[model samples]
Every structure is written in structure tokens, then in C-alpha cells.
Target: MRCKYPIYLLLSLIVLSCQRKDQVVKRDNEPDIHILQGEDTEMNTAIENAQKSLYKFKEAIESRNPDYYNFALKERFNTAGSGGEHIWISEVQYSDDKFYGIVDGDPISTTEVKLGDTIEINPHNITDWIYIDKNIVKGGYTTRVLRKRMSQKEREQMDKENGFTIENE
Candidate 1:
């Protein structure tokens, strides 16, 4: 029995170590925003133009064509005050004048946020809104699945160079 216990302990340790360290375990309530698989750096970017209306952003998300735009939302301050900016990876969905979406990936918050929870964003205090539209290559097109982080400027530059432009309002 003692020898069996030792073998079992060793097996458990090996199993735990084989698991990916970056795997994010979410709670039961939150929505599932499965942006990427496996370990990779989280996405973050600062939105340069605050004057733009949310309508533009809303339209993009609701269109349901964003198969390659993965992003992370960083917390911010506004009329809502602190703790309002719950940082999480999510894809926004607009319906009935309210933005609804799921947590796409792990969040930077200590609070318990599940993978498929509804996300709320104060239309005004949004920061770090960086993403890329679908990609088109020579003779064919491809979805933007590369887990690389890009700045707002870089994203815009890539858009223009690729002949794909996201309207700004």
C-alpha cells in the first residue's frame, strides 16, 4: 500500500507539471470569450481618439465578421469612477442599445470573472482599443490568428497598407 501511494503521488505531480502554466481557469458565471488557445501574451493598446462615438465600434463588433480581431480591455476611469474598468479579454456585441459580450480570455482583475460572463463597458472611458481586421494575402486570404500585440498606430498602418480600413467616427 505504501509503494502504491508513492507511485500515485509521482503520477499526480507529473500530470500537474504537464499542464500549461498559462491556462486560465474561469468561474461558473462569466461568459466564455475564447480568443486564443494555448499560452501567449495578452493584447493591450491605448485608444488615441476619445472623441469618436461608440457607434463605429459598435457597428464593427455587431457585424459578426471579425474572425481575427482578438483584444483585451484595460480598466479606466470616468463618471462611473474606480473599479468600473474591469480588465478582461472580450468581444463586444451590441443589441437593444446595450453592449453585450463574453470574456474572451483571462482578466487582470483579482475579482472572480468567469469565461462567459456578460461584460459592461461605459461607452466613454474606453482605453486601449486595438485590433486588426481580417487579412488578405496574395491569391488568397487568411484570418488574423497570429498572437502578436500591436499598437494603435501599427494597427492603422497595417490596415492602410493592406487596403482595409475601419471607419472612425
Candidate 2:
């Protein structure tokens, strides 16, 4: 237990020491632009959540298999997956980029991605990549595949926005 205390102290110190201290470069005095591409984070949520809420809404209304869903939704389900192959989606247009948006807010974080920007998100892995559409959502991109690689500062920023805890690495 005595040795464990030293290791714990070391970890805590390591976590605290390397906070956000560096800065991005000044490009024409504007913030450095980061092009984020690939994978929708909200899609990682379970299909059943959408099925229960989204499709269910359309299904109940139309009395048929739901291929149509609402344009804005905020569903909380524990599926933790990119909704599988069988899901049909409504397109959310952000200038040109289309993302599978939830019923609540926009899908592609507009503040994050810009049009004509070449960004890469490894949906499956870093080596595996797909070209992000500046105006459309790729249907086959699974939530698991497009793993979000959040930078330290970005993660902290998102955590603050979402009111969640962030672990800095």
C-alpha cells in the first residue's frame, strides 16, 4: 500500500502538470483552422434509441415501417454504436456538409468543420480512412469506425460544453 501511494501521487502530478499551455499559430491574426472530418459522434448512440423514438414516431404516425424520422431530436440510449446498416436517415445540410443529425441539434459541429477543407477521421482506424463529403453524410460510416480522436484542448473544450468530465492525456 505504501508503494501504491507513490504511484498514485505520480499519476496525479502527471495529470495536473501538462495542462493547456501552448498556443496555436496566428494565421493572418485569425485562429488556426482545424479541419475535422469523418464519423458522427451522436451516431454512436444505440439504434434502438432512434427506433424507439425516431422511427417509432414516424411509424406510429404513418402506420408503416419507419424510414422517415424527425429532423431534430435528442435521444439518450445506451447502445454505444453507430446505428447499423438498416437505418435510413434524414439529411441535415450545413452549408454543404450533410450529417446524420439528431432531432435536437445539428450533427456535424459546424463550428468545428469548414467546407472545402480536407480533414480525416479514422472511422475504423487511423490507417483506414474515407473522404468526408463537404455536403453529405456517408451512410456506411459506422459510429465505431469513425472513432473521434479528440485533442487534449479540444476534449477539455467539449467537456466544458457538454458538462462532462474529461481526462487529459
Candidate 3:
């Protein structure tokens, strides 16, 4: 009886200490995996707005020949990734119901991101977007001249004032 009790105790301990090894789980109310679409709407709207804002800014810079240069938009996701201040998103585009971004000269087409390799995230993983504008400073150093997130309404107003139409196709 004592031996049986110790075996049961050890088995219980092992089971309690173990965690689910799968990245996804099947539930009665939830799916086996988290699909990117139909999960995040705010992020989708934010990205769309960011795209519009960038388009307007680029057009203005080109037409007016602004001194500012090297402007880009970046996004962060909820997926597991290394902690860093430098966000690596060069571009974001939609293909096959998922958003892909260029990070560090490579395209990220999946949810899991590799270490030191900036990649796009599933739409559901997106947390926020950053609009960055870098300008050449003294000593040939590029400084962040502008960094902020604009709301969809704000972008719309700016577009109207600049005589730009945001045509999403």
C-alpha cells in the first residue's frame, strides 16, 4: 500500500509539473488555432489608416521636396519575440488573408518570429503601429524628426486638407 501511494504521488507530481506542449489548443468554444483574420478589427483599421497617412506624407514630400527623408511605418505583434527598442518593419501588405511585412531585408509570412530576424506578424498578433521620419542631422547622424501614431479620423482630415484621396482597392 505504501509503495502504491508513493507511485501515485510521483505520477501526480509529474503530471502537475508538465505543461501542454502544443502551440494551440482545441476547445469546444474556440478553434484549434488562432487564425489571424476575424480576430482583430482595431488593428486592421489602424493599419489601413497608417497606409493612407503614409501615402499622403509621401506625396507631399515628393511634390514639395521636403528636407525630411527616410520615413517608414512599423508594427509590433503579440507573438513571442525578443525585447528591443528598434522595431523592424519596412513594409506591410495583405496577401492570402494575412498581412506580411518586410523586416531586416526579409519577408515575414508567419506568426512565429525568429530571433534577430524582423518579421511580420499575424493580424491578431499586431499590437500597434509607429510612423517614423528620420532626417539628417549634423555629423551625418540620422535623427527621428517625427514619430507618432495618427488616428483614422485625423488622417482623413489631413488627406482632405492636402487634396489627397485615400482609395483602398
Best by TM-score: 1
Q: lDDT tens string, model 3, 1-169? A: 0112211111110000012221233345321221223223443455455445544443533443434332233444333233211233434444454445554212123344442353444443332333222321111001111101335684454444433222221
TM-score for each predicted model, relative to the true structure: 0.37, 0.19, 0.26
lDDT of 1: 0.34
Overall lDDT per candidate, in order of appearance:
0.34, 0.24, 0.30
Q: Write the per-residue lDDT of candidate 2 for residues 42-97, one digit (tens) a residue.
A: 43332333333333232332432232222222222111233211111222222232
Tens digits of per-residue lDDT for model 1, 70-97: 3223223221212322233345545677
Look at candidate 1 and tell me the lDDT of residue 80.
22
Off by over 4 Å in 1: 1-45, 48-53, 62-86, 108-114, 136-169
Worst 10 residues of 1 by lDDT: 8-17
Q: Name the runs in model 2 displaced over 4 angstroms.
A: 1-102, 106-147, 166-169
After TM-score superposition, the amount by which residue 165's alpha carbon in candidate 3 deviates from its true location, in angstroms, is 26
The order of the candidates by TM-score, greatest first, is 1, 3, 2
TM-score of 3: 0.26
Between candidates 2 and 3, the one scoring higher on TM-score is 3
Top lDDT prediction, candidate number: 1
